[model samples]
Target: MSKKEKSTSVNKKTLGRILKYIKRYSFLVVLSLICAAISVVLTLYAPIITGHMVDKIVGKGAVDFGALKTLAIRFVIVVAVTAVCQWIMNILNNKVTYHVVNDVRTSAYKKLEQLPLSYVDSHTHGDIVSRVIADVDQFSDGLLMGFTQLFTGVMTIVGTLCFMLSINAVITVAVVVITPVSLFVAAFIAKKTYHMFRKQAEIKGEMTSLVNEMVENQKVVTAFSMEENVNGSFNEVNKRLNKAGLDATFFSSITNPCTRFVNSLVYTGVGIIGAVMAIKGRISVGQLTSFLSYANQYTKPFNEISGVVTELQNALASAARVFELIDEEPEIAEPADAYVIEKADGQVDLSHVDFSYNKDVELIKNLNLKVEPGKRVAIVGPTGCGKSTVINLLMRFYDVDAGAISVDDHDIRQVTRESLRDNYGMVLQETWLKTGTIKENIAYGRPDATDEEIIEAAKQSHAHSFIKRLPEGYDTMISEDGGGLSQGQKQLLCITRVMLDLPPMLILDEATSSIDTRTEIRIQRAFAKMMKGRTSFVVAHRLSTIKESDIILVMKDGHIIEQGNHESLLAQKGFYYTLYNSQFAH
Candidate 1:
């Protein structure tokens, strides 16, 4: 789909979700409506009293002090009561909007967590962040402000029409003749503006993504001297955003002014008719003055309604984007009848599995593998040979298209995803560490792990010595992604985290690839110790790391070309022999 079409679809979904959110807080909505009604009634009384005052002052030659004082007191009391009601309405509206926004933000965040890895792989991080933070925030105007003005505007229009019609039907009919035309014009402007606003939001998300990419990869850009290229891309997105913003603003600007012009015409016509009636003595001066005031009051509400329509359109655009995210089906989810697989003994088997990320291209074809309990199997493969795909299938990150994977004699598909995942500890190639103390990072696998257990795990992974050498020992705070540590240290930290979990099964994907040769040797030794009595799958590019494995599989082009013990594979002098010789020849 085109970007515009995708954006429109997303926006419609977002709006639907927003309505659901509003429904969840129906009690608050009802309360806000009650407060708005009370405030509107008090507001209407103010205009009526003002009109009454004008008539009394002009119609009576001398003021009746007692009657005038009573009218003034009643007006003040009504104003005070209305002011209180408005204050309550404001408080209630704020509370409702805050709760709604809070729920939206929370829901958006949760949805992000539940989303499959495939969804994240396909979208930019900044774009998703913008939806959660910026787009969700826009709902305040969409739901709260729009709802408030709509309620008040409707009440004002109805009340003014009733009072005006009662006093003088002819004048009321004349003033309201253009009402339908004004509404049609407002609706037309709103529809046009909605598209513009949706475009503006999309451009903003793209710009946000661009900025995020530039900031996160600033080092790479500087190293490659591609600052100019980065800046050009950023400028392009910024220009689109600027153009869309200007268009939306220009369209929104016309709405209020046009409505006011139409209202002005109505007021002028009403005055002319009222003046003629007064001159012919068909209506008293007081009545004519009162009728004029009501006509003028009527225009204010229509103008407010026009402005609100534009805001509502913008809000709908935002809501639609949010809903699209919430509506997405997760690529990976627990089966309806998923059972818990507790006490896994760690034996893993992949039988006749076929899989692909895209339908037409199979990444892994008819793959079969088995790892006995407490066995160390190392998979050595060239780049893009489906080495990681094997690990992904073992962890059930993506289900097989055909056949089944089993853990401890149980088909993994029948187990709850969480229970299956809980049985394994993984140390990925990329060492991702949150900002926290060294102890916290290590204990992340088991949050409730005691300090002693954390220290022991760190020691097992050879991270304890380096951690202790730091200024604060276990208490030393690590920057995000372990910024304060060396690459080797970060890898060790990830290893320590996994060790702390002490799961029956383990998968280490290039766990020591980034470390120095010397550190790799130490990490390998630590890993060997951890794998003594556990099932392990190790994907390594370094042949030296897997030479002593119980079984070594040499893979190329997504298929295992050779599999045997180290000596047996070397004896065959096939794909495995070629790879080992080629690496040593370097």
Candidate 2:
């Protein structure tokens, strides 16, 4: 199909999707349409009544004052009724528009939740957020404009044309002749600008992503004194967005003036034709006057609708982006009869597991491991090795490309992800805390935990001393980034969270890397207590932290180079030996 045809198809699909959300409020939409029709009919009647009142005045002395008075009263009532209907239409439109936006935003958010980790990992957080928030806002504005103006505009045009035909068909013909010019202008510009607007939306997303990245990493930029470099990168993105916006706006903006100019020509032709008919006695002067009013009304909607079309194009572009996110392929669905492991014995086995983020780049190949219940297994590897990947696979964040990972002798893929994750308590080197109180953050894993349990967990993680130092103690509010909290303090809160729920299986990936040595020792003691009688996987860079593990797996280039107890691995004097000695090399 041609490009134009493809665009038309996509736009129709987008509109169809939008209608599905609007259908939920069909009753309100119907009421709004009725109001629009009523308002347009009353508004159209005003011109006809005015013409009749004008006809009552035939050269002052022969004026029919009584008839004029009756017409005047009717005109007043029509205007008043029209105003009331228009008011009602606007109210209903706002309700439908905002509610539809809310539903779309909610669905987009829920879709994000169901999406695979790889999809999210591949996209910027800000771009995803933009689709959910900013794009939805744009769609709402466009929809509101379409509801308030587009419907009434179309109705007014039809109403006026009917009125004009009843008065004089010759003048109506003249008006119709120039109407297509306005529509053609509007359509041509709209078609040319839709792609530009889509480009603008994409660039705007990129700009949002850049801004979010800068805000989240401001400290890193400042510490590295890379502000100039970061600013340069931002400027580059800003330039592209600027050009996209300007190009989109420039094309869409011309639609209104061009259509309005054509509409003006249409009105001029009606006035000239109507006047000639009145002079020739084919129609009364008052009838000619009414025809002129109808002509103006007929052409007015074209101008208003052209503007609405421009806005609708923009809205459709944003809606498409949001829909794109909603339509993304979600994570692999679980089996129909997936097992829900409420209480796992925590025997995890990876047999011949092979995986890679990129298919061309091989990573984990034929990996195999087995962890008995209640055993503490430390996976020590260099930065790029598969330590964290193993944790991700265990939690089913990403499935293996080959082979199977089983928990308690059951294939992990065969079990429900929620239940599998419920069995494991994880703490990574990178900590994440939502905007809430310390007590709330601790109770995240178990929201029903008593305050006493939360407090005890905090104390065990050694975050209680710091909590007491704050003004509100455990109730002190913090931002999502753990504002006003040091890295160590944030890590303590994370540890406190795991300590609160104490799942049957634990995955600690450099969990103590952020805390200081003094605090680290205290948190380690807490972890040791938490790890007791629970299967644990510790991915650590600090060899001293994992020295006490029942078994240590040394990984290099995605393959296990060594696996044995600390003393046994040391006695081998291989990769594990070199890594262990390097930590205490000084």
TM-score of 1: 0.95
Candidate with top lDDT is 2
Model 2 lDDT vs. the true structure?
0.91
Candidate 1 wrongly placed segments (more than 4 Å): 1-17, 59-61, 331-333
What digit string (tens of lDDT, one per residue) describes model 2 on residues 124-212?
99899889988999899999999999999999988888888888787788888879989999999999888998988888888899899
Candidate 2's clash total is: 0
| Candidate 1 global lDDT | 0.83
lDDT of 2 at 279: 82
> Which candidate number maximizes TM-score?
2
For residue 136, model 1's alpha carbon misses the true position, in angstroms, by: 0.6
Per model, state how many residue pairs clash: 9, 0
